[model samples]
Target: MVDFFTPDQIAMLSASTVRCDFLVKFEFASSTMRAWNGNTELVVAGDTYLPMFGFGQIDGLGMSGGTVSENVTLSLSGLPGQALDLLSVALDDTPEVDQQMLTIFLQLFTDEWQPAGTPIPIFRGFMQPPSVSRSAMQGTEGATQSISLTAENIFYSRSRPAYGRNTDRDQQARSPGDKFFGFVASLISKTITYPDY
Candidate 1:
């Protein structure tokens, strides 16, 4: 029962001339990844504020005609060394527990400068491990690096609900059990016997 969009915001978004700005925030818990510090400002390599190039729509794909998977990809340009290092940690296969993952929140604003009202929380999830890449050209243009990170929401891990009967248990039998594996086993045992037509 959470309200993601308000009436006024929805109306403004439907307008063709509405202007929106992007704000990115990174949340991490590690001494090496102390650059962001829960700040709303988008800072890279400790000194630069790189702007986002664009973002992919939050796509949902139906799995098995029941469960739906959702994810979004965000692209950033001119990422600094610090940001790259942070991404590297996430991409590592055997990183420390504290540096294993990081949560990234993206917000959209209707105004470009101050006096801007509270932005809308368009996306909030953990950044998928990504491999960083850089490109350089010999022309007059300098070198630039772009980073893209995809995040999966809660629905990405959800599956279709199981249909079955529940077993009654007393307080003495209410012990902890493997809910996930147990549920899967139960579903597999309930084989439907269709009429022999």
Candidate 2:
């Protein structure tokens, strides 16, 4: 619902010639992979995004019924042999909560292939588990592999509990020395009645 475009990015939108690229950052356990659905590698904010045609498409980002979806689906594909190595990352998500998955909209100027302005982050969320699939072509000698990653919006966490208890013991477990909630538990069963005037 909120517009995240800068002045320059806004101006670039209504220009005569507008070109845009999508940059996807996948933060994994061992390494962070930066990829762009572009013809060539691009460097934005000093970070290089590898050219990857496998960033097939992104869905669930559009508004529906005045609200955005909680999860966005990212489709990626490559040779069956490589599979973009995303399958491993997907499988690694079991023991840990996957890190932030960022997707930015990079506006490119057609004249010299330079950026119009600072890129705008279109999708910011943590990636859930991914689903991988493989299929063979009718006449091709090799097969293609694809993975669908569901990126759960960060706002979805607001509906979940933080697991914090309003007790001195619980507070001490977290801070070890802080007793901010020390009196909260004792006050639960004690009721102070007001005297009649």
Candidate 3:
């Protein structure tokens, strides 16, 4: 059996393209921009936590336990133009064959839709370097060995949580996009500070 978490070992996998439905959910809950790249530091993307609660001897006394949630980390880097080429070189993949799907919208183009909905498709394609086969080479003395190729899925997204009593809906209902947007618009809307390259 193979241990998936040990990425340092011998084989190098590739992720040439990804196709999917809905949006590829990130921490900011936004789509990826094409022309962004750099050696950016890792940041907490998002979290999905399940709160634990236990009942005490008294009916009203409920003790709150620890929270369990999956945390995601995102490290954005590299210029858009060089991303595919760089990733291919670093991952030992075929740059010529990999199209490098960058946006969630682009993924929808790859599918064959049905009447209701389509399958949630994700992909990882790679061109592996050739390994010399001693037994096979003996039979065909003149021909050279061919490189091994492989592709597989590595990551997947999970469903978001349902709304409850303590949900953000109450806050939104009260303000209706008024709080932060109004505050920022009044304070710093006129500022045109340039971004650091």
Which of candidates 1 and 2 reaches a greater TM-score? 2
lDDT of 1 by residue, 89-154 (tens): 455643332223333423334555321244444445555655456778759987666556566655
lDDT-best of 1 and 3: 1
Candidate 3 Cα lDDT to native? 0.25
Task: Kindly report which residue pairs in candidate 3 clash with one another.
Answer: 27-45, 37-78, 38-78
Evaluate all candidate structures by whole-model CA lDDT and list the values in order.
Answer: 0.44, 0.65, 0.25
* Candidate closest to the true structure, highest lDDT: 2
Off by over 4 Å in 3: 1-94, 97-136, 139-141, 154-197
Off by over 4 Å in 1: 1-11, 14-16, 29-67, 80-112, 136-143, 159-197
Give one digit per residue, the lDDT tens place, for model 2 in 1-197: 33467666777787987877667777765677777666667777788777665546788775332112377888877733342455666666643325455454555565677766666676678777677888777685667678787887766555423426455666687788897876664553365666847
- Which 10 successive residues of model 3 have the least lDDT summed? 51-60
Tens digit per residue, CA lDDT, model 3, 22-129: 222111112222211212211212311111111001111111221222222212232233422223332353343232332211112132321112212222222222
